[model samples]
Target: MDLDQSTTVESTQSGSSSSGYCRTNSEISGFSEHLTDDFNSCSSETSSPVSWPVTGRSPFRPTLSRFGAIRHDHKLEKDDKLNDQKPTDLELEMMKERFSKLLLGEDMSGSGKGVSTAVTVSNAITNLYVSVFGQHQRLEPLYSDKKRMWKREMTCLLSVCNYIVEFVPASQNLQNKPSMEMMISRLRSDIDINLPALIKLDALLIEILDSFQETEFWYDEQGSMSRNSLSGSFRGAPQPQRKEDKWWLPLPCVPAGGLSETTKKHLRQKRDSANQIHKAAMAINSSILSDMTIPHSYISSLPKSGRTSVGDTIYRSMISTSRFSAEYLLDCLDISSEHEALELADRIEASMYTWRQKACSNYPKSSWEIVKEKMEGDKNVVLAERAEILLFSLKQRFPELAQTTLDTSKIQYNKDVGQAILESYSRVLEGLAYNIVGWIEDVLFVEKSMTNQQES
Candidate 1:
C-alpha cells in the first residue's frame, strides 16, 4: 500500500509540493463487493452548515484597450536608455502599456522581478492537491470523461485571486497613483473591509463541498453508490471499516487518469511552463499581512486569517482525497490495510466517475436546505436551480461541454474540485477577464510594492 516517494519532485523555493507514488497494483481486479446502499428512508448525518450570504464583486473589466507582453525590473527612476535606435510600432505600443503599468515608468522596483502573490496562491491550490493520478503514474484511459472537477475548482480559486489583482490602480494619474502611503493604506483598508465577505464565501464553499458528499448525488439515473461507503471493502483479510459512516456518500476526483498518454505528455509539459502559481499558499496563518509579518509578498493583500482566499481551503479540503489512496489512504479513511486501500481507490473511482453533467442537473439554490411554509397562501418554494440557460456560452466557448445542465442562481463554483460558479456563460467570460486583469495587475502590484519599499 505504501508506494515509494523516492522519485518525488523536490519542493521549490516557494515550497511548492509534488505528489509521489510507485508501482501500480493493477493485479487486483474486481473489489470484494461494491457496497450497494439503500437510502430509501435515510437522513444525512453530516449537518449542512447555515447558508452564508455571498456578496461578490462583478469581477473582470479591463482598464486598457490592448496590453503588450513586456517584463522588466526597473529602478526607482527611469534610466531612459534607448536600446533601439528606432522602436517599431508594436514595440512602441508595448512600451506605452508598460509605462501605464509602471506609473509612466516611474520605476516600480529595483533589479529583480517581484514575486506575484496570485501566481504563488494559484500554485498552492495546484500543488496542495497532489493526487494519485496527476503526481503518481500518468494513466490515459481514465481521463477527459473526468478530472474536470479539478479544472472547475481551479477556475474559482484563480477567479478570487484574479479579482483581487484587478485592483491595480487603473487611474489616469499614473504619476500620482502609486503613492507609497496612500496605496498601502488603500490595500489594507480594502482587504479589511472585504475580510468579512471573504469569510462568508469561505463558509459557503465549505457547505458546497459538504453537499457534494450526499448519497442523493450518488443516485443520478446511471450512477452507483459512493466509494466512501464500501461495505465488504477488502477480501483476503478483514480491513478496518470507518466507524462512523455518513449519508452513504463521499468524494472528489479528476479523470486525468483516463486520457491517452499523448495528452498526458502535453499536460505534464504545460505544468512546468507556467511556474507563477507555484509560489502561492506559502502560509495560512494570521490576517494581518505586512513586512513585519512573514514575507508573504505573494499574498500580502490577503488577511493572515485568509483560509481560502478561496485557494487556502481548497488545498486543505482536497488533501484528504489526494491522500486517500494505498497506504496514505489509511490516514484519510482511518484504516490500515493494503487490499482495503486498493478497494477504496476503486470505490472512489467508481463513485467519482458517476458525477456526469445532465441537461437537468439539480442541486439546491440555498447552500443549506431551506423550507417554506404555506403561510398566507404562499405561491411556491423552489429548491434546486435546474434550468440550464443551457450553456448558451458553452457553444461559443467549450461547445463540447455536452451531457450538460445549468444552475444559474447559485454563487458557488470552482476551478478545482467541481461545481460551476454558475451554469452561465458569464462565469466563463468572468474567469477569462479575471485572469487577464490579475496578470496585468499582479505584475504592477509586486513590482510597485518592492520598489516602493526601496524608495522609502
Candidate 2:
C-alpha cells in the first residue's frame, strides 16, 4: 500500500487582481474579511493560507511581515526560476510544524464562529502524541533479521488503527458547525480504512515481543489502559498542574505471553550465537548507511527550490522516489505497458537470486563485510578457523570447484567463512535481499494489478 506517499498536499492560490487576492469566496475568505481597510497591498504567495496570521506583539510587526512576503512574491512572480521554487524537505517540515500548530488565531478570525481551518493544531499534536508516546505501536530498529526488518517496516506503514483511540469532546462552540461535521466524517473514514490495514500489516509481518509493544492491547480492560501518556519510551510529558505525574514514559506494562522452556532455550542459544558474531563484525560506524550520490545533472534539472540548501537536496530525493513519475523505473527497465512492468519486476526479482545481485564474498562491494574481518584475513583466529574448516569440507565435496572458480577471486569463490560463519552471514544477506525485493514488489504488483483491472 502506497506507504511512501505523503497525504498532505498544497498548491499556490492567487486572485485575478490585487484587490481580489485571497478575497475570493472560499474558506480562507474568513481571514480576508478581517484584513483592515488600512492595508496598502496584499501578499500573493501560494502558501498564504488562512491558517497563518502571524502574531504582532510589542517587538514584532505583522504589517512589515506582509510587505516582506509581498516583496518575496513579486520577485518570484517575475523570475521563472524563483517562482517555481518549492520549500526543501526541511523547510517544508518546518512550515508544516508552524502550520500544524493550528493556523488561525481568535484575534485574526475575529470570531471563532463559522470559520475554522479544516484541520487544527490539536489533531497534529494528538497524532504526534499517539504515534510516538501514546499506545501507538512502533517498529524495532532495522536489523539484518527478516523478522526484525519486517517489524520495523510494520511501523513504516502508519495506520490510524495502530493509535489508541482517545476521544476528545469538541468545544461547545463548534458542536453544530459544518467544519465539525466534516471532521466527524473524516474521522469515520480514517477509522474504516486505516484500522483494517494496520491489523493486517501487523499480522502478515513480524509480531512484536509483548514486552516491546505499546501500552495496552485492545483486549485489556478499560481501566487498565494508559491515559494521556507515552508508553515504552521511558519518558514523560508532564503537564503544568500534573508535573509530578509523568506517566507517559516508563509505560506501565503487564507481563505477557511466555515461552516454554525448550523453545526459550533454543532461542536463547541462537540469540547468543548471533550476538557474538555481530559484536565481532560490526564497527562503531556500521550504522551509517551508504549515501546516495545524486548527480549534478539531476540537481541542475530540478527547480531552484530543490538546489537552494542542504535540506532541499535531502528532500528532493525523498520527493522524487516517494511518488513514481513512471519515468525512472520504466526507463531503467525499458518498459511502457502494465504487462511489461509486471514482467520487468518479475525479471528483476529473479535476477536478484542470481550471482550478479547475490554475489559472494569475492564480488566487488560484497556483503561479506559481516564476517569479512574474521574470514578474509582470519583476524579473529578462532572465528577464521570455523570458516576455514567449512571451506575445506566444501572443497572436498567438489575438487573441481576448489581448483577453479570457488578458489579464485571470481564470483563463485568462497574464501571467507566456514559453515558457521557462512550460515550466519547468509542469514543477514538473505534478510536484506528479501526486504529490498519485497518493497519494490509491493509497488510493482500494485501498479500491475491496477492496470489489469483497467484492461478488463
- lDDT of each residue in 413-449, candidate 1, tens digit only: 1121111111111122212222222222322333334
Top of the candidates by TM-score: 1
Clashing pairs in 2: 51-103, 133-230, 230-248, 234-250, 235-249, 387-417, 387-418
Let me know the TM-score candidate 1 reaches against the reference structure. Answer: 0.19
Candidate 2: clashing residue pairs, number: 7
lDDT for 393 in candidate 1 is: 17
Candidate 2 per-residue lDDT, tens place, 260-350, comes to 3443343333333322222222211011101112234432333233123213422233235254332342344353443343333222222
Error of 1 at 455 (Å): 76
Best candidate, lDDT = 2
Cα lDDT, all candidates: 0.24, 0.26
